[model samples]
Target: MNQCLAKKVSLQILLVDSYDIALNATAQLVKTQYPDGNIISTRTANDAINKIVNWQPDLIIMDIYLPEKLGEIAQTKTGLDFLQQVMQKYPKLNIFVQSPYVKRLVQIKPAIVKHQGGFVIADKNVTSQEMLSIIDGALKGFTRIKGITDIYIYPDIYEKLNLKPEILKLLSLAFNEGLQDKAIAAHICVSERTVRKHWETLQAALGIDCHELRNQGINIRVFTKIRARAAGLID
Candidate 1:
């Protein structure tokens, strides 16, 4: 290697997160490792996209939920779509998803595997040392998605069951809001029949046994919620 080329590159980190506290905390934590690192922070997907296209940072630490624009409510789909676009365009970009919703990345596991760059995930609540360790691994091209790799549900299973991201939204509505099928349909602007079909699909994907539930005199919906919670599909 040329002597100049062998010199270490200064780390460049881009953080895409709408929340100020998390963004600032993560930036400070990263600075602990690379005191002279360059960090760019963006609060919206559009802003982050522009930065990524122009700057090509060495690594990106982003939340899976972000606003599409300034002053907009942060949304998971918006961030996920942005991430997909980034991955498609920059297959070798190192990425770390820092959020409580890391499980949602399961919907894009196939693409992650196809990516040639470092990819890692950690819940927002992890210790600072753990976060730094994960970041180090990512910069070295390692891949790890916490709470996602240990699950029995694989990407192929998600494909086989057609478990789209919308299913995650449906689960949140059903369990977090305690919404019935009719109410969920109204909220999501879908037909009641479609909501019922989603429930059936979710139940099937969870390997729920309706026969056993009936025999045990348990309400199928309640049992499904319990299973989904245990599976980390819902809070």
Candidate 2:
């Protein structure tokens, strides 16, 4: 590879997080690895993306949720236009997009690949060194990983709420428009009361009163985003 292309191996990275502590933790983690690589940390994707445009980092590591702008939707740091620019100008650019929720990553994968980015498939329990190696591999032009993804649930919320693995499957069922509780219960092969009880537990765990969150938005589509933000997805 040419000097400029080889330099991309040590390319800087940007991180956009809505939650203060998570953003700082992630920035510090990256600094530990690439001590000299520019780490553009910000509170919003807009600012992060702008810095990406200027600094032109070879990679970006972003969590899905943010407030003020990213709000409930855990959008990519660089929106579609910026993604297009990345493909055009920095075809070798790497992106590691993560969320606390695996379902979110599954849903968002197509979009990530559209921008030529990859996912980290390791379980959250993996060591930080293992996770860093996943990121390094991506920068080196490998997209396939046998383990879990890098998107971690911010430790703040992760510690607060211990969600069951089944919740996401149940949520995927609930996100359907016009799906009644009875139908969801049937899908889960549980009684309606059981379904309601689980949903209640989910609401309580996230520290959001279900009725209140539901009151704010009638559309089921926003529930994924809402649950994520409620889980403190700033990192």
Candidate 3:
């Protein structure tokens, strides 16, 4: 590998884990990819926050089960709250969550989406190569958290968006099943007029205007499908 391009001029990496073995092992693996990296390890959320505020590391590899302070029992909620705080304060910070309870991340899906930085997750049991690859990907601004199917929207906001089940079904049938509007109407036992109405409603709910799309020389259906998928309204 070209050292210059691969290493990115030596990154500042922060490893946050209360376990000495996990922290040291991750730092060693990071050294293999970034030989000249400045790696810092912190065992508690307070120390991690202090290091992050002071050093502003390029990447943060953290565990979900972490303690808030020395001599405190590590809890998933503590780490999660700390992670959320960090993401809020440094919206563009690259974060790599190396944890076994990756599923619990679904709770903060909304904030993750709003983050303008690299956010990647991997199970703690992944192979060294896989973990390194994910870390590399995070450095390159990749957001890949596998098995996370939904992005949580607030209940009131979701209701205000007016995303009804029929609208979601329409999106799935139109995009997933590859059906035309007419065919979608037939499949759902609705009239073509009602199907057209559904399309108009869906477009409005998604904040997509058909006229605006036409003005921009864009395909409305295609754009809608892309937007729906981005919003987690469809597969």
Candidate 4:
């Protein structure tokens, strides 16, 4: 939140999909094409919005038909409604809604502008690069070089530093940006001492000095995630 931090800020993109296959393919394409850009996706609209608020992504790639919960029963919600909320609160954020529900978007064009959200009405059949283009036009506002594929493709970077999931999650939570170790431990339902043991194992595997990995949680996390992605471990 520092002024200096804002000066060096990069564009963020959020992909919201209720379905995993569509979300993962889109995410992989986007991230593969533009690695430097902080592109992230979530299955839950709430979690999507949470990251949107925290990361302030310049664009949102959204889909319809969210799982719903009404008392004991679950219902459904539109991804557009979620987009509308983003527009209301973060009008500057651009959006590209990709759904088979193009007719609904045509019906609701008025709402799109009312919320000040941008649009790229995409069918389920749209190609990956076209989706990339929607994201491309928005990044210019952030003063980044357009259409240069800024995403970091460092599979070897992750490959060089292998780690397990439990340790990976802890590193992402605690090491990156110095999140509290106690909080990370609590989230994993383990003690701080146990977390340290995991760290020790990671240190041994990566050939990193224990003290260095302890301080560089984000780096450790990135390596772990890359390795996981390479191994296709994510669901």
Query: Which portions of model 2 show Cα errors greater than 4 Å?
Result: 1-10, 68-91, 114-126, 145-235
lDDT of 1 at 88: 99
Q: Model 2, 1-235: lDDT tens per residue?
A: 5878766666577775667787687778778887867777777656765687788777766554544255545443224334444455565678665444333443233344554554444433457787688778766656753322334333333333334445544665665334667988788788999877766656665555556657886643356447654442311
Return the lDDT, model 4, position 165.
47
* Clashes by residue pair, model 1: none
Ranked candidates (lDDT, high to low): 1, 3, 4, 2
Candidate 4, 134-227: lDDT as tens digits: 6665544322211111222332323323434476566557544456767878889989898777756654544445457567665665565444
Candidate 3, which segments miss by more than 4 Å at Cα?
Answer: 1-9, 150-235
lDDT by residue (1-235, candidate 1, tens digit) is 5655544576789999988888898889898898978998989999999999998899999998899999888877687789999999999999998887877676666788788999998888889999899999999999886567766363344664454557777887888788888888898889999988887777877888888889999999889888776665655
lDDT of each: 0.83, 0.56, 0.81, 0.58
Higher-ranked by TM-score: 1 or 2: 1
Candidate 4 residues lying further than 4 Å off, grouped into runs, are: 1-7, 68-76, 115-117, 138-235
By summed lDDT, the worst window of 10 consecutive residues in model 2 runs over 145-154
Which predicted model would earn the best TM-score? 1
RMSD of 1: 4.1
The clash number for model 3 is: 0
TM-score each candidate.
Answer: 0.75, 0.49, 0.61, 0.50
Alpha-carbon shift of residue 214 in model 4 (angstroms)? 77
Clashes of each: 0, 11, 0, 10
Candidate 4: residue pairs that collide:
12-57, 34-151, 35-151, 35-152, 36-150, 36-151, 36-152, 68-75, 175-217, 176-218
* Clash list (residue pairs), candidate 3: none
RMSD of each: 4.1, 11.7, 14.0, 19.4
